[model samples]
Target: MKKSIAVDMDGVIADTETHFLNWYEREYGVRIGVHEIQGREENEMFPDKTVARKFAFTPGFFRSLPVMTGAVEALKTLMKSYDVYIVSAAMEFPQSLPEKLEWLKEHFPFISWRNIIFCGDKSIIGTDYMIDDHIKNLDFFKGTTIMFHAFHNVNHNHHQRANNWDEVLKLLVK
Candidate 1:
């Protein structure tokens, strides 16, 4: 039996940090350096917290996000031995469902529709392993939790960590 792995979209397979930086600079004309946001959540990084929070609600925001470095190759490698599923909490922003689906189709054509899960909560996922940036999601997971490194989660230290997709391959693709 293949052990299933649940993977997050934003800040995990998607380069959400870079997305924020690019969009923030474009919208506000103030470029916030990566170092300035380290160990801080996205909302806290912007001058106006509401501006950062509104980014996800903006149309085309999810579809235009850049894929994380090495994510596609790493996931393809994992798929040989694991049942990998892209699990995202998309209900908060209802408009993101279609955008996220389109983004996945564009970048991860190999992933089947059955393997994509868009739900309000991740606690229902029963995979043997999960990789996510949010501590809130990983906290309730019964499986082995691997914290994917993100600027927002730099201060977290409770779970097993993978700083990059290379490290993820090292940790799980045996």
Candidate 2:
């Protein structure tokens, strides 16, 4: 039997930061660079979280995000041995559900719908491994946690880190 691995969509496979940064500049006229995304709190980048939070409500915000480099290829390689599941804490933004599903289908059609999980809490995930960017999720995961490197978590170093797909291959692909 293959070990099952849970993967987060945003930051890991989806380019969410770029979408937010572009919206921030167009919506608020603030030019925030990727260098400024080092904060642990995502909303801290903006003067007020509402500025960013408000944009989350925008339609299609999560639908068309660009895929991260090497993610598709890495997963294709990993799939040969592992049961890959797309697990996302997306219930917080109910509107994003369909969009996320669509985005995943467009980019990762190899993943089956049955393997996709969109829930409110991640503590219920029962898998052999989890690849996520949030410390909150990684801290509670009862498995081998692989922290997918994201701008917000650059300073964090507790869990095993996979800075990019190449690193993820070495860490998970054996």
Candidate 3:
């Protein structure tokens, strides 16, 4: 039996930070540097506290996100050695379920629909390993946790860290 790994969709495989930065600049005509966002929550990245929520709730928001660098290839490689599942907290955003599935189909066609999990709480997951950006999810996971590095999560040292797909490959692809 293969060891299963549950991977978060947002900050881990999807370039949500970049999406926010780009959209923020387009909407506000103000460019926010990544350096300015360290240790801040996603909603706190903008001067207007509600902007992030608006962006997330906007149509095409999740579907238009860029794929994280090297994620496609790294996941493909990892799939050969482990049972990889793409898991996302899509219940919070009513429109995210279908958008996320479509995005996955476009960007990661190799992943089966059966392995995709869209849920509100990740604690129910029973994988052998989990990669996530949120402390809330990882904190409750019973498996080995990998904190995927994002500007928001930079200060957290609660779990093993992976700064990029290269780092993730090094940690779990062996």
Residues 40-115 of candidate 2 have per-residue lDDT tens digits of 4787867787877787878888886889889999899989999999999999999999999999899999999999
Cα deviation at 106, candidate 1, in Å, is 0.7
By lDDT, the candidates rank as 3, 1, 2
Ranking by TM-score: 3, 1, 2
Error of 3 at 79 (Å): 0.5
The residue-by-residue lDDT of candidate 1 on 54-97, one tens digit each, is 99899999999999999999999999999999999889999999
Please provide TM-scores, in order, for all candidate models, with all chains considered together: 0.98, 0.95, 0.98
In order, the Cα lDDT scores of the candidates are 0.94, 0.89, 0.94
Better by lDDT, candidate 2 or 1? 1
Each prediction's total of clashing residue pairs, residues at least 3 apart in sequence or on different chains, is: 0, 0, 0
| Models, CA RMSD each | 0.7, 1.1, 0.7
Tens digits of per-residue lDDT for model 3, 56-99: 99999999999999999999999999999999999989898899
- Which candidate comes out best when scored by lDDT? 3
Error of model 3, residue 167, in angstroms: 0.6
Better of 2 and 3 by lDDT: 3
